[model samples]
Every structure is written in C-alpha cells, then in structure tokens.
Target chain A: MAAAREFGVPLTLVGDRERVEAELARHDCTGLDIELWHASEVVGMHDSASDAVRKKKDSSIRVAFELVKGGEAAAVVSAGNSGATMAAGMFVLKRMRGIDRPAIAQLLPTLTGSTLVLDVGGNVDCKPDHLVQFAVMGEVYARFVMGLQSPRVGILSNGEEASKGNELTRETSVLLREKPLNYIGYVEGRDVFNGSVDVVVCDGFVGNVVLKLSEGLAETVGKMLKAEIKSSLLSQIGYLLCRKAFNNFRKTVDYAEYGGAPLLGINGVGMICHGGSNPKAIKNAIRFAYDYALKGVNSRMAEKLDESFPKSVREREANEAPADAKERVVS
Target chain B: MAAAREFGVPLTLVGDRERVEAELARHDCTGLDIELWHASEVVGMHDSASDAVRKKKDSSIRVAFELVKGGEAAAVVSAGNSGATMAAGMFVLKRMRGIDRPAIAQLLPTLTGSTLVLDVGGNVDCKPDHLVQFAVMGEVYARFVMGLQSPRVGILSNGEEASKGNELTRETSVLLREKPLNYIGYVEGRDVFNGSVDVVVCDGFVGNVVLKLSEGLAETVGKMLKAEIKSSLLSQIGYLLCRKAFNNFRKTVDYAEYGGAPLLGINGVGMICHGGSNPKAIKNAIRFAYDYALKGVNSRMAEKLDESFPKSVREREANEAPADAKERVVS
Candidate 1:
C-alpha cells in the first residue's frame, strides 16, 4: 500500500484473495490505485522449482507471471521461493529474443553507493558466452536503473590481472574486452564492496556464493557487536548512548533496503525477493518493479544484446563470425 | 623476536644479511637463537611467479624454501608474493606423496571459534580429484592443528542441497561421500562463518573470492559505522563513551587476528602471511608455523592421503579402482 501511495504506481497484489484483502483492510489503504488478483496455490520453500512450475498452474508465482503474459500487469514481484520465481518467470514470460538464458541481477550496498552483480543462482552451469550476456544485462541495469552515464564493468576473479582466473573467467574476460563497454579487466572479491566497479559479472556459482557470503558476514558482525555490548555494565551503558549510531550503521549495511533483484532477459520484468523480506522490503520491490516497467529497460536490453552479439554466441562458436564482431576481435 | 621469545622456537631470518643484521642490532637481540641467512636477489610483486622461480636463484623466497629443503629450518613464513611462495614451495619442497596438487588452507573466525577454508588462490583450475585432495588436507589441518577429534567437512556451493551445485561441485560431492572422513554435503558461503562446519573446501577461484569478500565487507562495515558515528554531535559523544566496546568489535572482526594460512600438501610447513599483516600477525604466523613443524602435519598428511586414496587418483581414473574405494562407492 505504501508503494502505491509513495510511488503512485498502480499495484496488484496476487495471492490468496482473503489474505490480501485482510492485509489491505488492516493497513487502511485509502486513496491508492490498488487491485487484487487471487492465486489459490502457494509454492513452499522445499517444492522443486521445475515440479512446482509444471504442476502448480494456479500458484502465486505462476499466476503473477500469467498476469504479465496476459497484458494485465507490466511486472511481477514475489517474496516467495526465489528458485520457484525464476522457474515461473522463464516458463511464463519466456526468454527474450536472441537471449540464450535469463539471469538474476542483484544490487548490493557498497562502501560507495551500490554495485550490481549478475547470474546470482540463475544459470549455475554457464558457458563463457552466457557470461558475456550476463555482463550485457548487468550493463543495462547499471545504466537504466542505477543512472550511471557509463558504468565500469569487471569480471569476478581470484586476481585483478588478466593473467589470473580459471578457464571460464579467462575466456569470459577475453569476450568482455571485445564488447563496447567500459570494461575493467578483472576484479577480486574485495572490489565488489570497495566500489571499484559498477557491475561485477560471473557465472552463477561464484555470484550466488558472493551474495550469500555478504548476507552471512553482515549477520555475524551484527551478532558479535551485540554480544560485545552486553559483556559488561559499562558496555551496556555505551550501547544505550550509541543506539542511534548503531541503527544508522545497521541501515547502511542492511540488504533488505535493496529489496528484490530483477530476473533479466525475461520477456517482462520479474523481481525475485528474499524470503525474509519485511513490509518495507516488499514495498521497495513493488516500487522497483513499477520503475522497471516504466523505464522500458527490457527493450533497451534487447537492442544491446543484438548490437553486442551481431551473430549470436552459438553461431559465433559454430565458426560463422559476423564481419563487425570479427573486426572488433582483431582490433 | 617476539615469536622466538614467546613461542620459544629458534628462528632464522632469510634476506639481505646487512639489512637483517641492522634490524637485529637496532633491536639489541641477545640470548635469542636468531640467525641471519643472506640472499642476494629479490622477487618483486610485478615479477611473474614462474619466471622468478626459474630465474631468480638467490631470491629470498627461493632461499627460504632452500632452508626447508636442506633441513636447516623446520618451517618457512613469508608475507611476500603469495604466488611466488607457492611456486617456490612446489619447486623446492615439492608436492607430498600421492598428492596431485597442494592447497593453501586459511583460518577464518566463525560464530563459535573458527573454520578452515582451503585452495585459496593456489590452483585456480581444479578437477574434482583435486578438490577431494583439498578436503582431505583440510580435514588433516582441522583435526591435527585445530585439535578437533573429528572435523565436520563441507564443500562450498550455492546451496546446502546435494542437487544444488555446478558440475565441479556436483562431481566433487559424489566423490566426497565415498571418503572416510566426516563429510557433510554442500554448505553455502553463509555457512563458512556461521560455525556450521569445521572446514570448507572449494576450488582456488571460489576460495580466493570468499577470503577477499570477507576482508572487503569488514572494511565497508567499519567505514559505515564511523561515518554514522560522526554524523552528529550526539553520535560523537556516544562514540567516546563506547570506545572500548568499539575496540572489542574491531578486534573481533579483524582478519589480522588470524594472521597467516599454511600452504598444505607441500612437503614442509610453509605459512603464507597476508600482505597487509602487522608485526603481531607475523609473530602469530611464525608461532603457528613452529607448531605446524613440531606437530609433523606434513608426514601425517601423507599417511592420510595413502589411506584415503588406496589407488591414487591417476590410477583410479585409468579404470583400476581399488577394492576399498569401490565398496565405499557402492555403499
């Protein structure tokens, strides 16, 4: 309701009708462009993503995507099982033209503003060409959403040097260099949070690990601080005095503020939320989804994919190289 | 000097003799069994690791390894180029018996105490067999050095589910289940510092990123806290009152407290210190290296490898499966 009131975006709550109405009535949502669409079935955490998508036709995630597919909604956002959301997205909205795979682009708070990371648990077994697409999709999000005139893109690796990384990163780095991007060669894990680059692209395995590691580290740090504050009477007194400062610090490192990340390369905007998302987080995700549709980022991404991969990755790998890409390759 | 005095281990300083002697004289070293060994050359950061190993015969890193090779020094510790150290270790000390590749094992402070993570920028490209070796070596370090009777070992992946991993981790998980050690399946990046497991194993690419990400996040959090505390006059006063609590927080999150990690699977004890390590960190590393030598981890590791891999990976891959391993695989 806050999202509709604050962002002035028409909101549609897709879930069990009674539950949705109950939340709206309790919140006293007045003078808001709010609508409700009922989805009888719910996808549980342990439900297999593939099985859920195939069998649960009326599931919340599936029904939400159907709304987008049927032109009733511009975007879909869900704080459900992220895997189910991704699976529903691909099965319903389908992959964009010339896009081989869709990827999840996540926003992380950095020392300086924020940075975007792509392929976070989306395509686990990604080829180098797949990573090339992730970088492009990441670029679009960094530009249109983050409002960067020109974003510095970096590939996540063990070392900063081009000579570093394994077979996958080594190959991906070479491909990224050919793109018309502000490509920084390579970035270490430290660079992700240090604000050295705007977008850090990697295969899903590495990116997923980075996302989870950041969350875990933040929790560990918060718990340690609390324990230390309660160690002595003087420390407990100090905690009371510094409560506001601590609150501000928590907000700064908090991941919930960022809310949902879009599953890019899909036909329409589909935002995947954290399972533990609060009301504020859900509101932020709704606002983000509304903006994603308003900005027409999907069409721009489609254009970029074609312009970047003139002959498509599979064709290029098949030895049928386009003249423009070949010329850039030599240069 | 502190390590020698505190840990009571005889020490040798390997570098330019004049420079080493000047430091010893300035410190008024007396009654300490400190010896200075001269090396005419050095391996700067920019120097290629392979080039240095082959060309720089008298380089300090090479000389230090020589000390171990000749049995003059029980262990070696260096904060220089980590790649150079690994190269020198492989060249002079050599890989241990039946070990296809050696790995660097790092200690990270967890929610409870600490956990060991291995293959941190040692071998970037690793096969499943190599990861199996990393797990075994990590188990050895955790059991012997960490003093855990039986360590809970886990593979780093995107999810805890056995079904959730890339090809490398998927294959590794199957092989790990056949091991005699206490093998927990997949642990996500969150599990590394959450005290969910005693040791986390991964390819060098993932492990290196994890290490750097932890460091970067800590720095980011500290900076955010400082910025918040200085935002207002009230926060500044609060900061003054909470100085000790803040200091305790810093120490708890400080990576310097862990000091250095040992390059396991090498024939001798070689502790690899962080480039930004302080004097106290260096002392801790030196002391840890002394304990590593005294405990005879290298020889014990060899025994473990043979016992675990009755038929070496190469031989097993050649279709000659050992009866012991074959039975375990069926089970």
Candidate 2:
C-alpha cells in the first residue's frame, strides 16, 4: 500500500486474502492501486526448500513465482522463506542464458554509499565457475540497477594479494582476471563496508555468513551502546542530550532502509527479502521491483553475461563445474 | 616488559638487534628478565610467503620459529606478516598427529564473554575432514585453553538447521555429529557473537572474511559515531560528558585487550599477532603463548583430535582431500 501510494504503480498482492486485506486496512489504502491475489497455503520457515517447491503448489512463494513466470506480474518480491523463494524461482522461472544457476545479489550500506554482495544464500555449494557467474551477475546488477559506470568488481578473500583465498576463490580469481569487468584483484571483508569496491562477489556460503554476521554485530553494538549509556548517571543524561545524533547513526546503518535483495541471473525480477522486514522495507522492496522490471535488468544482465564468456572459458567452466552440484541445486 | 612484569615469564625478543634494544631501552630494565635475539632480515608485508619462508632463512620470523624448534624458546610470537608466520611455523614446527594441517584460532569478545573462531587464515582450501579436524582442534582449544567445560562446537553455516550448510560444511557437520565433543548443530554467522555457542568453525576463507569484516565494521561504526557527534552542538557536549563510558566501551571491544591468535595444531605455540598490533596486544600474546606452552595444549589437542577421528573418517579424508592441495600447502 505504501508502494502504491508512493510510486502510484499497480501492485498485485499475492498471499492469503484475509491477512492481506487486514494489513492494508490498518493503513489508509483508499483508492490505492492494490489488488489482492489469494493463495491458500503458506511456506513456513522450517519447510524444506525442495519439498516446498515440489508439493506446495499453492504456497504464496510458489504462486508469486508463478505470477512472474506467467507474466501476470512484472516481478515477485517476498519476505518469506528465502530457501523456498530461491527454489521456487528455479522451478518456476528457470534461468538466464549463459547462466547455469541463479544467485542473490544484496545491496549493503557502505561508508560511501552502497555495495552489492552476491549469493547471500542462493547456491550454497558453488563451483569456481558458479562463482565466476556470480561475479558477472553482480557486476551487471551494479551497472544497470545501481547505475554505476564500469563498477569496480572484486572477489572477497582473506587478503588483497593475488596469492590469498581458498581453492574456490583462487580458481575464481584466475577466471575474473580474464574477464572484461573492472576486476579488482582481491578484497578483504572490511572492504565491504569501506566502499572500496562497488561489487563484492563470493560463493553463497561466505556471502551469507558475512551478511548474517554483520547484522548480528550491528545489533550487538547497539545493545552494547545502550548498556554503556545506562551504566552511569552522566552517560544516561548524555545519551538523552545526544539522542538525535544516535537516531541519525541508526538511520544510516539500518538494513530496513535498503529493503530486499534481487535474485540475479534469473529470467525475471525475483526479490528475496528479510522475513522479519517491516512495512517500510516491504514498501521499498516493491518500489525496487517495479523499477527493476521497468528497467529490463534481466535481459541486459543475460546479454552482458553471455558476451563476457569466451568460448574457451565456457569450455573450462563446463569441465571445472562438478557434476554432482547440478543435482543438488535445490537449496 | 608488561608481560614480564605481569606474568613474570622471562621474555626473548627476536628481531633486528638495534630496533629490539631501542624498544626495550624505553622502559626500565633493572629488574627485568629480557633477552634480545638478533636477525639480519625482516619479511615485509608485501613479500611472498613462500619466498620469505624458503629464501629468508635467517629472517626474524624464521629465526624465532627455529628457537622453538631447538628448544631454546618455549613458544614463538610475532606481529608480522601472518602468511610468513604461518609458513615459518609449518617449516620449523611440523603439525601434530591426526591434524593434516595446522589452523589459527582467534578469540573474539562476545556478549557473555568470548568465542573462539578457528582457521582465520591458515588453510584456505579445506576438505570436509580438514574442517572436522578444525572443529576437533577448536573444541580442544576451548576446553583446554579457554577453559570451557565442554565447548559447544558449531560449524558456521548460512542457517541453524541441519539442512543449511554448503557442501563442505554439510559434510563437516556429519563428521562433527559423530565426535564425542559437545557438538552443537549448525550455527549461522550471527551465532559467533550472540554467545549462543562456544566455538565456531569454518574454512579459513569464511573465518578470515568474518574476522576482517568485523574489524572493518567496528572501525566504520566508530567513524560514523564521531561524525554523528560532530554534526550537532548537543552531541558534541554530550560526548565530553560521557567520555569515560565511551573509553570503557572501547577497552571492552579492543583487540589489544584479547591479544593475538594461537596457531593451533602445531608442535609448539605459534602466536599470530596482527601486523598493526600495539604494545598491549604484543604483551597479551606473549602471555597467552606462555600459558599455552605451560598447559601442554599441543599434546592434549593431539590426543583429543586423534581420539575423535575414527578409522573410516580418516580414510575418507585421505581420499577426499584433493591431491594437488598437498603440493600447494606452502601458503
């Protein structure tokens, strides 16, 4: 409803009809371009991705993906079970050209502005080639959606040297160096928040770990600050005096301001949001999805990725990508 | 001087003679048991680890490790290039049995107290068995060194569910569950700080990423707070009012308070300090190394790790660990 009021774009709300209407009714969603598309079932967080995707046909996440697949909706954004959302994306929308698997590219608040970190939990067990694709996909997301010209791309490693990183990152580094993107050699984790690079790419496991850890650390810092402020009478008085400054700091670092992350390398705009996101986050996500569909990011992303891969690299990818990973792509 | 005064452990400072002497001369040496060992060469931050390890034989790090190898020194601690330090430890101190590779375990301040996260940057390319070994080594470090009764060992994953990790973690999780330690199920990155788990295990790539990212984020937050405080008159006045509380908060989270990470699974203590460590961090690291050597952590760690790995798991590791990794173990 906020998205409808703000962007004035028609939104097809897909979920249980009663719940959707109840949420909308809380706000003055009068004369808003909002349509309720009911889906009977819901995908619980504990439900396995594979089982949810295959059996829960009428699940909101599954139905939402179907809307995008059938062109009934421009995009599908859900703050639901991400695993189920990812699985539904693959089973319903398929993938883009030159891309073997889809990845989730998330925008994180950085010192300068924002940076894109890919595969937050799309494909956990990625091969070197899969990581390379993630780099390419992340690059496109930064360039087109984020509107950066020749975005500085980097693969996250322990060190900034070429000789750092695990086997996967090492192999991916070799592939990235040959690509046409503005490939920065290597970046440490601190680089993510420092805004040293525009796009930071890693396998799903590392990206997800970093993402969650950052969130946890930020929250912990907040709690720590509050405790420190309350420890002394002067600190409590000082905190009250500087309450405005604290609010500004919180606003700058809050993840809700950034909203959802788009699942890149897919056939359409499929956003994966935080399940506990507030209305502001969901509203921003809807606006982001609307902008993404209007911009045709998917087709351009596919085109750029296809062009980036030479014949030799493509062949190398096929050989390097493990065969067993293909069967285990559900999660 | 601080460690010597506090712990009364005689200290041997290894580095260029002139520099070490000058540093020690700053403080009173009348009643101090301090010895300075001279070295001709120093490994610069940019020098390759292999080149420094193999070519710079008389380098300070290498010379220091040799002191440990020759039984002249109980443990070796250096605030130098971590890669060079790691390589020197491998060259001078062969790994403990049942541990194919030695790992670095660093202590991080948590809400409750502290949590141990291992393989911060030791072995980037790890097998499932290698990760399981890291878990065992981490468990022993927590129990014997950190003095936890039975460390709640958790393999770092994207989610807390059993079906959550990547291929490496998934396989490692299976191995961890079979061990005799107080093995917790998979833990997300957020668990590293919430004090929900005692020990968090992951490949060097992931662990290193988290460690550095945390450092960067903390620094960034500090900067953000300063900027926020400066933006307003009330905030500036409030900062002076609560300055003591801020200083206390800083001390609590400061890395110097905890000191360097131990190079676990090695024959003797090999402490890896941050390159930018201050006098406080160096002092703490020396004390930590002295405590580790005194506790006979190496032998106990070896015993526990060997007991944890069954015949079948060891065989599986020998097969699963890639052949080429054995050749490229230098870095």
lDDT of 1 by residue, B170-288 (tens): 99999999988999899999998899899999999999999999989888888888888788877777777768877988886676677788888777778888888898898888878
TM-score for the A chain of candidate 2: 0.91
TM-score of chain B of 2: 0.91
Off by over 4 Å in 1: A22-25, A313-331, B313-331
Candidate number of the best lDDT: 1
lDDT per residue as tens, model 1, A161-199 = 778898988999888889988998899999999898999
Q: lDDT per residue, candidate 2, A96-160, as tens digits? A: 65677788888888777898998787477788898888888888788888999989999898888
**Chain B TM per candidate, please?**
0.92, 0.91
* Candidate 1 CAPRI level: medium
TM-score of chain A of each: 0.91, 0.91
**Candidate 1 positional error at A116, Å:** 0.5
Q: Spell out the clash pairs found in candidate 1.
A: none
Cα lDDT for residue B119, model 1? 87
